[model samples]
Target: MADRSLESEQSWKALDGEQMSALLRGSLNDYGAPPAASAEASERFRLQLEQSDQDPMDAFVEAVAGLTDAVERLAEIAAKDPLAAAASIDPSAADYAEIESLPKPIRMTVRTWLGRLLVRSRLYDEALPVIAEVDATESIDPASSLFYRGACYHALLMKQEALTDLRTLLENEDDCPIRFSRLAKLMVADIKPLKEDSLDEISRLMTDVTRRLDLGRSDEKVEGQEQKIIDKLTKLIDKLEEQQQQQQQQQQGGGSSGGDPKNGQESPMQDSQIAGGSGDGNVKKKNLGDDDGWGNLPPAERKEALQKISRDLPTHYRDAIEAYFRKRATDG
Candidate 1:
């Protein structure tokens, strides 16, 4: 009898030709795949093996992709309605309920592939439900399921969950695929320092907004996310301005107020910095950068623009102006 314990310990990374052959045949049998389909898949697997000495994980992924294609085709054939084919292409569609009729092993493989497909398509929200169905430890390719699910989580900004799966993938360094481990490591690093509603979070949200727009999605959800970014930016700017005002106040209180006969050195505390204008009309404009509403400009022009915003605009009006300019830039 074969060593059941040894077979259980066998990692995909260590599988040789004979072992892989047996695995393919066993999986096919377990799924009760048709004889003709089995023959074709076997031939394709043999050709894939011969074409290049691919990593076992790579080979496993290709095999699963093939299985998904076969399953989709089978679903198409079994489907009475012509729309079933279209539904198969969309993960959100209900026609994939046919996959529930498949045997356990086949269903897991199909779901894993669907999860990966949705992630690659940048459909992180749609991918999560499908990916959550597979337990990584029990998956045929643990590394693949773990990495892709973690990736989907990371893309959706689920930091802790992403870190959980990614860190788990890295824990089994010897058994895990090198490519996946490396990517997981990078994603973990990216997610580590992110704090809620901070500028970094807003930047990530901006990136997500851009990604959605690129995908031709301008739905209410996308617009809502955009509004969140604007709100965050407004809060951040308000906090910064508060800090700057406090610093100016501190500097003013420290200086000799009545004996200011200094020649070209402007007063550190200017009435112009205060919230409403004094009759003097001397307002100072803060500097701007790439992140601000103003694009890069000559120092003089930047100063001019900042003066326009700071002098005439209220804080909320400034936010609205920034949002309008941002939308214009995006449209262009």
Candidate 2:
């Protein structure tokens, strides 16, 4: 009885007569053989052809033939012309579908590539779903995904969601915040009214991240440790991103910028004069501590000055700027 049942199961899974016929037809098409006239002939032909054919693994080899080429080309575009690649919809969308169709380990490579791509294109929404799917199926560096996901949540003003992700990142990512916590702050500000505790937690994380990364420790050990700390800080930011924006808006009337806090609007000359200002007098009076002076400078001059400040400022502060730009570069 057991033997009969096993045979029955085997027959059930064996390709139906039609499926066998199709394989036989395909084999004939490939080998230029005459068509079979009966089901038995077709099945016999298919089995014989399958047994005599080139190694079955050859299909896998052929399937991956273009992989290296595609990867190299995509990497070049991502590195040399990220914006150009990101500007097109095909590369990003097709990449997801392609990865989903691939075998297990192959999909990991695709996921990582898509991760970097999503970041470069600022397609946060598109990236998140793929990340979630990858997480469901495989193990990856949650920190990398966390950074992008937090940024997306913050940008969309989903404070609670951002906070949850950021907090996890903070705990698990080492010193990631030493490079990407500003997004947390932005989201923190938006969520403060709903979860004041999250803001406090983020502030505490930021403070910790700042102190540890202080004084430009470029030694290898310090650098690696700093990274671990920064990762933790990123999680904190994500945790705070979900705080209530509308409530905060009602509570503070949208925050106070010395200029037009409402629109964040500043004239170009105002930007220039601020950047070109002497370290004293009106600039000193207007500057929000030293950061305001350099930070408020015109965008062009601010570039070099920011690099210099990165050396002089607290570790957390420099990381905050880094995170802001990292988020921008990745999310576009």
Candidate 3:
């Protein structure tokens, strides 16, 4: 018998949210009135309460209250021990029939408790109908009902419904509890895009920078601003590379790459110097710094020299440089 009980418990836990709810509804429909054996047990319970000088009606009421309190406690425990709570309640228990006939308010409270418990256990589909019933009746706490329903919709991948409920709670921020309001706001933000097509915009900006630099028509201030944009683009590329590597690692079931090779920490000007001539056997090394003959040119001539140097670098290196300058202009 104990082994059979364990098997039943395992089977219940193995079911999905929809299957669990179906089983629960079926059990409620099939439940019967208290049997002769249970009636005898209740009589003994009443007699024991009477021995303490309690009125018979009061004793019965107290016993019913105690049972309700126990159910409430079990609902709380269900958050962490959903399978245990589900298995603990015998489907054939006689009292379940009486529970089906409970007052409307009491039934709503019970549904609210069960709905939240199912949600906490990650049984979103099972929670939805119960939560919806409570919400339709408008008997349960409004903030709690909204949060649970919103969370269920999110888990079920119904993004629009989730956003609507979450936003509604946020709109009445003063009426809603602080915790629920804050959570709704977080959910809404998470659903929204981080930026408006940022990658495409980055590519377009880089192209514009290349065109401007190619013209070689800039003053000292414009040249400085262009240099800053190049730096920003380099950083953006590094960040995008890191994100790609992290995704690949996750897909491969490996740990993080820890460090990505494409993430360049060196300044664009320094990188360009190294890439252009530092180690190339066929190319003559030239001092790229202002301390070299570069400082001798007038402001306009210096700017033109810098632009010619930028145009001559490899395309990938040039893009990184251009992006850095473009970012500076936007930020400034």
The prediction achieving the highest TM-score against the true structure is 1
Clashing pairs in 1: none
C-alpha RMSD for every candidate: 11.5, 20.9, 22.6
lDDT by residue for model 3 over 1-332, one digit each (tens)?
A: 33454343221112222332333333223333234433443555445544666533223323334445544444555557754544443346444444445444345445565666777766664577666655423323455666778877765546688887777656556556687778788877765542332443344345444444564535664465455445555565455545554554586654332334487433345333535536546857866776654324455644454466556656765656565556657889
| lDDT, candidates in the order shown | 0.66, 0.46, 0.51
Supply the TM-score for candidate 3.
0.33
Residue ranges of candidate 3 with Cα displaced over 4 Å: 1-100, 192-332
lDDT of 1 at 28: 71
- What's the best-to-worst order under lDDT? 1, 3, 2
> Positional deviation of 254 in candidate 1, in angstroms?
3.7
What TM-score goes with each of the models?
Answer: 0.60, 0.30, 0.33
Clashes (backbone N, CA, C under 3 Å), per candidate, total 0, 35, 13
Q: C-alpha displacement of 321 in model 2, angstroms?
A: 30
- Measured with C-alpha atoms, the lDDT of residue 143 in candidate 2 is 49
Q: For candidate 3, what's the RMSD?
A: 22.6
Those runs of model 1 whose alpha carbons end farther than 4 Å from true positions after fitting are: 1-70, 74-94, 256-332
Model 1 lDDT, full chain set: 0.66
Model 1, range 1-332, lDDT digits (tens) per residue? 85566544433343345555556656676666776776677666767777888744445545644655556573444245323333453556555665565555455555676677667778776677777777664455667788899999898789999998888777666767688878888999999999986766776787788888987899998989988877777676556555555665677776744444476434455555645534587758866555763433445654454455456655544554466457757978
